[model samples]
Target: MQSTYNFWLVAISFAVATLASYTALDLTGRIFLLASARLRHAWRLGGAVALGVGIWSMHFIAMLAFSLPIPLGYDFATTACSLGLAIGASYLALVMTTRARLTALRLLSGGILMGFGIAGMHYTGMAAMDMTPGIHYQPGWFAISLAIAIGASSAALWMARALSNDDARNVFQKRSGAALVMGIAISGMHYAGMAAADFPLGAVCGAANGVNTIWLAAMVSLFTLAILIVTLMLSRFDARTTFLVGAVSKLNGQIIRLATLDSLTGLPNRATLTERVERAIQSSRRERSLFAILFMDLDGFKTINDSLGHSVGDDVLAAFSQRLLQCVRSSDTVARLGGDEFVVLAEHLASREDAGVLAESVLERMRHGIWSDSQPLQVMPSIGIALYPQDGDTVDTLLKHADAAMYEAKRAGRSTYRFFERSMNEAATRTLLIQSALHEALSAGSFTLHFQPKFHGGTDSLVGAEALIRLIDSKLGTLPPLEFIPIAERSGQIVQIGYWVVRETCRQIRRWIAEGLPAMKVAVNLSPRQLLQPNLVAEMLAIVQAEGVPCQQIMFEITETVAMQDAPKTIEMIREFQANGFEIAIDDFGTGYSSLAYLQRFRVKQLKIDRFFTNGLDEHGAEGSAIVSAIIALAHSLEMDVVAEGVETESQLDILKSMQCDEMQGFLLGKPLSANDFGDLLKHRTVAA
Candidate 1:
């Protein structure tokens, strides 16, 4: 009992002696943060210094609780070796990163610190020299100290090994919290060992002796464990809240981008474009500067999309966008208005010519042609330029004039640019007036079909008649197909217009048969857009059956260019039409790429040579006669009939007859007239023959 009391007294003295050194080391570590401006790097260096100071403090603090009875030489050797191990462990911990593979650095450092701290504490406890002068060795004290040192080192080293196996866990793992648990466990082991150590032979053993030891051990253990668990729970809850907040911020950014951007082309959409334009207008007005707006449309894009699939069409549009970017300055804003349409806004332009030159550059680059299926495909653009203050002061006026200029550019040959002029507004007004009148024509049934007779050259007798469409506005006397067909096609009103043609043609055929006229075949031109419709053939057949007209008496004509778009699908549709007793004719054969392969594949009834070729046949010095001869011979070999259109002279008719052309339909026979006029001609022909 006297010896233990002396050990406690020496431990207190050693703690008081080391207090000033620990305080100085901890204060010096804070100065490391000022060496660098970067927070993260400075923190890394500071953290290493803090760890070194912590080990130093832990060592001296442990000395206050343990006492040793070793000679000065042994004490010096053990303390030097222990400090050396601690310094080496701290250096190793510096190289280890949370980003690298986990290793035993933490456990090694903790084990080294604890090992030295225990050694220091044990030596301090033994310094009192309360043993007898005989200096008899006691195995019980040696065993107790050895057991406590080995137990504490093993526990710490095991924790370090576990931490080394997983890097993620090491980063978030509660270091101080875990150290607290370990500290309590080690304290319990030390107290239990102290109780087990046998003291002097005369020493008294009492109930109060073990009672104080157990009470102190329990109090320290429970207090340390409670602190550890609460710290860990609070840290994890804070991390989860931070992660959820960051995720919501990212989602909100994505949603905002989608709302303002165009889904298909990734350009600012119409709403966003309008907002930006308004802002530019306001800025230009304040600065008293000029800006130009150019509206561009892809020329012949509809033909390309219809011929190829929409997938290829998408590639062309994307490529065009990239090309457009190369033509404008970085200050300009370019946006896609819709399909094959784009608009550019250029600020602080010196003149409208600047916008025109940019538009020309875009067209020149596109004219070189793009590749499709490894073949060169041509694409071009038509642009209309409207200057801010020069064309109009308001947004609506600028847009209106730009649209008129674009139409003017299209009228004056595509692949060109046009500047807005005052006169263009008159043309625009005319277009709008025509649009209103056409709508009235559709509702009032003012449009009519004129039948032109088709004659067999060999027999010189009527075999069939082609149904020609015409529109009669109330104000205007009569309108040709070219005047209104394109407008209808653009507005997607051609589908309805086509339906009207079919129903009215069926009604006319029934009337011809009812009037005791010969049962003549009636042919009607079908637009490619109409032919691509899935239910078109069925709808036409239904109209013929409903109107009491024979399907064989109705012939449907489609252009050669339209038939080549999807040859397989076109052939299937033709086969269905033939099965229903409706003859198919390729009208305007030579205008586009007329392929013999497509002709043989589709196997139609007739080919109507375009008027351009027929009009040339009468010129003796021209090569038109040779072209006509080749076409007729080709048709004969394919077992298909031929019809020469626009035949206006006897010489042309005679030449066609010699070429073995099966039919002729032009002004030479009779111009397309009203149905009643054609009926009168039929009566006159019957009497004359």
Candidate 2:
């Protein structure tokens, strides 16, 4: 008897087979695109299970649609074996495709194994049917079916690989189209295999009875649908998870940028600069190339900031940073070290001369001035360059040496550049030594005060004295103020040192008063750093009060440059001091760039003519006389007493007396003496009186 097929059941079976094929191809394609090596294997295995079981299920379901004239049933063992073969083949195929690049050999090998496995499954399922007379196949039709299976399997593998490749565009659309083609190919192969089998007519066959064909078909369809639904849900979930991961990665990158970049200039910060320098060092070692570091400080930035306000200062800094960027190559890094200080790392430099050229270019760019709020503000750069290998090896050493050279440039004059030299290193070493020694000196009481007396220019009578610090270390004996004062200021030890000076001056003055000596105002010089101390006025007053000295008997002297550093704050501080009965004097008056208007604004008691004008008064002729005369006249107009500093000769004193200068102090009249020597001098003067 010939086999009779249920047309509707066959259609439903093919529809189910097509759906399963589409679902499997889509899953396999996604698995191929996975970036993680570990996750790819797990996803591929899951895909193999779906594809293998679905293919086997489709064949079995289609088999149930066909019926012989007699009863038909399946052996449970044989059916299970066919399903196992299909899954094993799928696993092998997926492994082949994903293990390496999809070359022709790999694709062909994988396709052959999968095709043979599917063919074996179809024939094995056919053998499960219990019939007295066994079924046979036509050789020609069987060969055609086998060919169809191999061809369709190879094409499916190729299509899936193409979709996974990065070069492919419109991946989703292409993958969808590929799925439809795969479904058709798989369904066609199944039908061809079914047609290849022949069931003879009038054959006496033993009927193996168990489940109905329609019920079996329904169960397989339901199972295939469940598997497909699960696969679809998983694919969607995977896509959502990937999108969330990508979004988080982008957010993290933004946060890192914010941390490493300057908010105003948008340049790298100190932390980022340090990291880049380390990286550059590594690269230079590998490439055997040289690099340079440039440390730049904007000269007079404090003046501009105080005069024009911080908002304008910010605008100027932003504009200057843009110009700085234009002066360097894109490969170089520019970073801000906070508060008008910037650093540049230039990589792959040819020689030290290249660094010089870069430094000059930076200076030239800064000369043009930055425009802010419709006003052009001019600021100059003091650039200090340190070369790789020549300057120092490590980042800290280079930065330290470069900063030392920058101060050298500032001392030479503003608006210049200086290359790091061996002398700078020596200076740096000395500075470090002084800083270490200073702390020890402060604790050990190695520092003492020396009194330099001022005399009335006309009468040559002792009037007052200036308190000077002397550090007498046992080993380093008698270090001058010039030797360690700058170091103290730079190391931020000036504030403590200043307080000591105030307390010691008060103590000496109180002792002199107790001895029945005439009370005279004693002046103490305050460093620029000390002037910036927030509690300066209160701290000094407390020290003087604690030592039982009258405020009027002590004078606080500051240089013009120091007074103008933060003009408004300086004015307020000076007012506070004056209000407390402390006298304020401008020391080294003629040397600093201060306007007469600002000088007049100060509620000061005295102005001391700087030493440079007084030293060569007899030799300098009219120019010297004119400057001294003008200063005395100006001081008289401002109702402030004028004190001539560094008056070393009788002739200089006569010139100051002629100019009506109030007082004079120098080595010629009285050398700086110990407190005991000053007391003896006072005693002798009292006896002379």
Candidate 3:
């Protein structure tokens, strides 16, 4: 006798199978994205229970739908065993589908394994009937049922992965269509297995005391449907929770960045620096080891800002921050304290020399510099290192000492690093005093120009004078250019001091002419910051014209370093100044690395030999006399006059005269004089020849 399926009960079984399949798809896809193994394992186990019950309930519901022609009830022990097989099959499906490195071989192999597991579950459920003659399966229908199981299992695996990848659109439609196909596959295989069943006409149910069939179908269907629904709802909640957690983490990271990083350079800010230094201090104290805090300030960064707008300066800063990050170790932390000042915490250092090594590396890299639109801008860093335990124990003290050392580095001419010294704090205090006095001196009109006259080396007649600014402060008392100029430059007062020098020189030239002194050219030195001023030439010309002084009567003196700093820019500005009939001279020549090609390009009126070379002239076959002779010859070849400055003795003057130096400016001829005294001397021609 053959068993038949009830169409209505069959529809219920198919519906249950469809829902279970859709839940399996949802469960596997969501579990794949979970980062926690424990959570995923919990979900996998829960999914297997829900999905396995659904599959088992659909099988039993369909079995209940079949008209057996004999009163039948399932064996209690076999029926329970069938449920175990179903749950095991569901677990196998979940595990196989969620592989990280899913490939064709794994997918094919997984499908076969899952297919066999499902068939085992179905066959075991058939055994739960336990008829008198036992339900025999026809070979042909059995083969067809197994084939359907395998093909459907493969199709389900492929569809689950594909739908997950293509989930951006038509989400409901895609899952629904897939669920329909899965329902048909499961129902067809079950019905095919049912068709294979050949129950004898005289068969009797063996398990008479087993569960009754009357309410079992309704109970299993409702129970399995509830489990699937609850599982799907929880899976949806978990997915939303995961998304919310990820979003919150991302927002928190951005907030942290805003609080701790410099907005302009993206380096750590001062707060972060303090925190890192504190951490390092704690760690070092525990380990009884050393670390270093490096405080760095960019040399001449103000001049760069004053010369080429702040925007370019910002670009340079950003680029160099990246370079500094690259140059340092991963254990080190770099921070921007604001406006050209930065700090680095070099942790786990073995010796103070290691800090020096890092500073040298930074200095070497900065020598090459970052290029902005073809202009190689130097980003020199004056770094000061303060060691842990040796320098100080607290963050504030270490930072202060490092800052004092950095000020000392700048005083020692920048482009270098210095370890913290106790004496530098006093020097730093003095620097602050001088800076304060500069402000008062500027307001009180205590700045005055002293004339240092230059004479013809051959005729000993005064040719011109260099106007040097002197500061007369009651508190600081008489300070020369060397005593305050560098400090003034660092404090950004050089530009104002520079303008004052130009205006005073023009006024003194007018006074001298009024006293009947010839309108000889008087040179005024221009600071690097002054030359970078956009309207420097125009402003100085206005001062001279207002004084009713001829442009030829004024000359501008720039250091060899300033002239060679940015060759093309300096040459262009020199030409602009010369166009207004003002002569340009390279002051302190041979003190800087000057390119001969660039020197020719400069085309200035004169070169003022630095006093360093002039001082060594008295020694026989001295390097100074040889260099001086070569310089004078080179100057004449280019039609440029060579002025030997800082002449103090007849021997030095005679050496310059022997080298045919065109002019001399030193104490040997005349000390720097007051404007009126210089005017009187020029008017009376009082110097002895």
Candidate 4:
């Protein structure tokens, strides 16, 4: 009973040491990685070595505490050599691309290899040990010990690798049955090897029944079997704990990815970008180094999307992104903010001229464009360049200036480059003022819609009028569409403006009905926001019903640019609006991406041809006239009414009449006026008639 208790204590002590060693290794490993950020690979290797040493020390100490009869061996060099070989082999495997993504099986293979090394070391040490008095040459002990070490190492490596790969909670869920088998196998091998260890030949004192070699072998087999069962149980418990540790590791990886990466571009997103930029900026400021910020925009990308298709455009963008990365230095950073725009932070530029030269190089590379297949495609990048300290003191200032310069490049020639100018600041200030005023104007009811008569081409009689939204800023007087529309769109204030336009238009239509005036269709332009909103359809329907107006008399005009932004969504929206009895027209048809395919799919009732083509109809004759003629013909073929916009002169109106254009609206017909002014005009038209 006392012997049994002592055995239990020894087993418990070893188990406790095993647990403690693993806990210590995990804590040390985390600290090692955290401390060695710059030399991560070297530190990680050191950490592994440290863990092995720790384990080895713990095992030896525990054994000593147990006061086992096993004596110390000479030639500890074999143990060091084995460990070194194991570490070196593992490193080779880790570095190889073929084995870089290490799996449990590979780890197990490595562990087995290490086990051989460990076993060899153990046997060599045992062989050198002075055990009792004289033991003869024991080849069996060496072979058995070698095999036992190899098996144990293999099992340990496999278990460690498997546990590291899996999450603690999920390890049991995806339990590897083979892993458990390997564990049992390793324990069985150890017991068998120990039995085979040629202990000094001695006499059996109290075996009276039999003392044959076969009986001795049978006794060893039974002993090994009992040890195997116990080993298997212990291994299972250890595996469970290993899996839990693995789960924590995987969770940490996920957190790191989320914190550092931009999900869309698969690039160092905002957090990482800021960190890198801040570091670079600080270094530059301290060292008086020159760096450049390049703000890039793809020219006419929106047109390509509205014209060719968005999918083709996405391919263009992705390809362009790759090309942009190829143009920059390895030390530089390239990031995509979103949608047709990218930013490059170039470190350690030689001078301002260097920034310009790099910008030009990038622009030149972008000029040829990327060909997806055999087809040669063309892409243009407008790059705006800003230099550190000279252009701005901070990242935000540099980026903003660079962005402005990029637009300047676009305005000058597109597919070109430009450096930041002092004048850009004034322009930005003006834009900011306009944007601020727009919000105030919306709230104070300073925004009003003007309706301009759209006359039938042949009869020259008013058919319908288009509602144009205009904001009256107290300080800025009246702001034109050109002055504020783009700003509003960028600021996301267009949605509010669009909503007001629709509501006011509907109210005016209702007023006309109340006045018993002849029913005339009124068109209100819908911005991208108005169309994209899931609840927009419902809101518009509500307005129609509340106003008690015929939905057929109300028209919603969507720009070609906005329509192509999301074709599927646009198609659904148009169908829904049409179902509610509202007429849908493709606005600014020829000005932005001309896609005949969408005309077939869009279910649009009309096409509003922009005035640029119509204004020069007489001078360019056939070329200009043909463009208009083709659009009108295309609209006719699609069963769509063509409305010519920006018609100022009777000469343009004459051309439209000859082409049999359905309707027209432009400055010549009369600029957009307030609802009250439009009401007065309607009364004047009635009196004149």
Candidate 5:
């Protein structure tokens, strides 16, 4: 019997197939982009169901478009089976095309399997008609139809493989064209399969009452089309989810950074280091970074505290931390672990040996760092290193192991570094043995002043001196100023020690004048605690007045660190000292991060350059000379006398003279001498007069 196809229904079926192909292909592209497994699975499952329904709707709608001399209807059971087969085939097709590397062999195999699935669905839907006389197939036409089904399936797989890997929305026209070709191939296969089926002239549908005819097909088609549309909308939402995930990740990173930084040293702690590194790994999948945790603490840092006071220790820690920053590359992370403890997070090293070299550089910088010149301070870092992956894969484990190694370095006689090992513990502590001795030594009047002469830059004649404090202990013999100063400062003894110093220096000045000797200005270093004393200016003026010495003969030197304080009271106190006739000088000028505004605010009469800048001047002439020259010119402009401390070697002396330094104090001129020796020198100066 001859049957005619309805043109409108046939066109609608093709449209449904194209829309389904476009949606499925777009989802496949999304699957390729998604790094999350859950998202990929969602798109994959949704694409399969929607595309499956669309394929089934196309076949059913096209079948309903046919008109025959005999009645035609579908059985409920068989029609449902056909729909299941279509969905299964679509799912299998999507899986094969969405592979990361879709080779020809894989595509060919997938195409064959999917072809059979589609053919089974088409033939099964034909069976749903249940023609009474029974439907037959033309042998040659049947083979040709089956061939077309397989060929079209292969073409569809090829199209999906080519276009699905890219962001299809970016190449919109190209993707649409691919979808159209796939749609035409699918429709052609369905039509050719139908052409092979023959309905006998007396045929009547046995299952005519099982399901409705054209209206049911239209309803199914509309519902499946809606599914495809929804699938496309979800693909768009997937892109938004990606953008939101990035924004959230950045905010999390910011919170970690803001929360973990140490206020004093401006370094992160152990707690947030791990979380940040983990996030880094997620964002950069390909990089395998090897980090080293150089756990360290200054060996004699407490000495800086004991002698100079905690305020100076804090400033030194801050300055040394900055020096530590400059010694390493920008990629590394530096963290302070409270007090003098610090960790350096060095990244992307090739081997454990590279971490060792980096640790060495860090140690070198800390050993020769900025300081108050008279203390003989040796606050070297006792460093311990732990490497990544081999030493530890986690941040906490690495830091812990590294700290153990650092203690090992301390035990092995500090001022050196060691790599991490399992058997490490028992750090040596010198505080218990010597801290008590500091108290006894102070009570027994062990402290004495040694004078280092400051000479005129041009005449090389002694114009003044700096009184550096020392400790002579019966138990520990003679101790360097560094040994007991930080201990004294730590125990609140430095304040009293400071008062003794002022009184003793005044007495020595009185003795020299009584001997009919020339009067010379002497600079006495004041601990920060002493500088903060409420009656400091009054007490100091009283000492000079009691000794019958002029206030100009005894100048009080506050460190550049103390001079940098912006507090109103501190500034007022400094003004009070100057107002009371005691000339104020800022010691360690280059080392302290003093600002020009603060410099102007203090209005000190003299600015002393710390040894850190002087030691490098002769060697690093271009860089160092430029800095020294700037300081001298700046000091002159402010009507302040410029003194270069730690000026050793003729080269340094000559350089200082060329720069027009007002005064120079260092070993090159003379070592610090006793009060008796200073008197004898003064006696000779009187003889010269």
Candidate 6:
């Protein structure tokens, strides 16, 4: 018997095949978009079941659509086996595609396997037919059918992958279009395989086969349509959920940035800086390398804020931060530690000099100055440097030491840099102690003045005395100038201490004059911190007047380092002091970088040689003697008097006397004495002469 197709049943079969194709593609698309691994696996398995059942149903329905001369019935066991093959094939395809990228190798392998599977299902279902003679397949048509299955399967998989890549855009439209194309391909493959089937003449169906063709076709169609509808609904829900999750993820990223970045400069804040430094430390420790931390404070930032207002100040800060960023490597971190203070963490340093080079670059860049609006701003950087495993090993210790070094840089005269040293930490501790003691000592009158007399080298007569400060604490005993003067300068207590020294020295001078002591100028050392004060000259004149001491009887001593810092300002202050009959002397003359021009510009009355040049005068071939001789010649040429310091040995005194040095003061002449003791010395010197 020859089979003939039923037109209406064939159309119904095509509709069922189309619906199954759309459902499978929709489910696969949804599975690809799922975020959770567990959910993706679950959905993939579920999709395999739906697709397998749908493909099986479409095939069976098409089988039911066939008409023949004899009745055909399917064997229940063989039919169920065909269904299993279809489901197994689908599961394998889903697993293969989901596990890895769909390379050409994977696509070809999956296509061949799925093609053989579909062919097996079709042939196995054909074998389910129980008739007088079993159904057979034409060799040529079978080949055509197999070709259709493999080609269609490969095309469908490639399309699915392509559509899923566009999931971020109009995904539903793309997937719907993909589903339409896949449906046509699957239905066409099914029809091609159906056309290969051949039944012999006079075939009769067996009673053991209980397949109902019409009812089975209707039931399969209804079941597939329901699955397709459910697949569509679930896909819509998944797409919406995915959009919300993506939005939430973006929001979380923004929150993270806000928490870690500075609002104005957009650089990392202190918290983020700390975290990055910790990470850098771990990396450096693992690699056995070094890193440096630089603490920077903007000089004259307060002046900018006061003069131009904070709005302009903020602009300057932002501009400066950008410049700073340009100076460092991308691997390094630059952070703002609030208001005019910034820090940099440089990692993976090959040597300590790398940090120095970077610091020099920063100084050079800032040397040109930063601009705010149209106005040019001049702000310098005072940087303190600390190295890992050398200065400190922890974040807090490193930052603390770096901060202390930064203050040291500022104290060394701003606009410079300093490295952390072990002694700096000790000095910092001592500074805190002295600061505490200084306040109490100042209040309790525990401070006393001592005078070291300066003598004329030729006459051996007293010419002047230098007033030195001493701090006497019940707990700490007496602290020398080295111990307390630096502490006072750093703590900003020098202004008060300097005023007290001037007042007491003047009062003592007046007392000596009343006791018939010959009048001699009393010299007081002025700290660099005091020289920067605007009222220093005025304060000294007022103290001299209040104590009834003539201005010519008092002299203010400033270090060469202090005077050379701002030459124009130093010259102006010196001229004002000289105009009022107060002598100005440069103490520690040879130790600093003061030029001969500055000495003449200030019209200084005297030059005091630093002790380092005088201490070694007794040694033969000592460079100290050569330096002392040169200084004496330089001072005399400028019409300025020379006083040699630290003259302990008679040999040093002999050298100075031969050099025609005007005066000498040290332990050899007389140690610094109490005011009463100095008065007695003066009286004895008068009697001796």
Per-candidate Cα lDDT values, in order, are 0.66, 0.81, 0.85, 0.65, 0.79, 0.81
Better of 1 and 3 by lDDT: 3
The TM-score values for the models, in the order shown, are 0.68, 0.60, 0.74, 0.61, 0.42, 0.54
Task: Note the residue pairs that clash in candidate 6.
Answer: 1-200, 1-201, 1-202, 132-204
* lDDT head-to-head 3 vs 6, winner: 3
Order of candidates by TM-score, top first?
Answer: 3, 1, 4, 2, 6, 5
| Candidate 3: tens digits of C-alpha lDDT, residues 80-184 | 888887788788778877767668887888788877877888888888877788788899999999998888888888777766542458876888899889989
Count of clashing residue pairs in every prediction = 12, 2, 0, 11, 5, 4
Indicate which candidate wins on lDDT. Answer: 3
Residue 135 in model 2: lDDT: 77
Q: Cα RMSD for candidate 4?
A: 10.5
For candidate 5, the C-alpha RMSD (Å) to the true structure equals: 14.5
lDDT of 1 at 496: 82
Task: Count backbone overlaps in model 3.
Answer: 0
Better of 3 and 4 by TM-score: 3
Candidate 5 weakest lDDT stretch, 10 residues? 424-433
The sequence of per-residue lDDT tens digits that candidate 2 reaches over residues 400-472 is: 8889888778767768999998888777676667777898988899899999988886677788889999888
lDDT per residue as tens, model 4, 1-689: 00011344334334433432233223222322233345446534544454333333322222223222332333345445544543453343222212335575665566556666444433332343334543344577546656666665554444444444323565543334433444344334433444444445341212123334233333433443343334334444544665677789899987888788655555666567667778888999899998888998787676566446778887777777777777777888988776778888899988788888888788766666453454444467889998888888877888899988886786576788889999988777777788889878777898878888877776766677888877788787887777788677656688778877877888897777577665668898887655656688788888778877788878999999878867888899899999989999998888776878877899799999877787769678889999999999998998889999888888888889889999888888777767777776666663212
The number of the candidate with the highest TM-score is: 3
RMSD of 1: 9.6
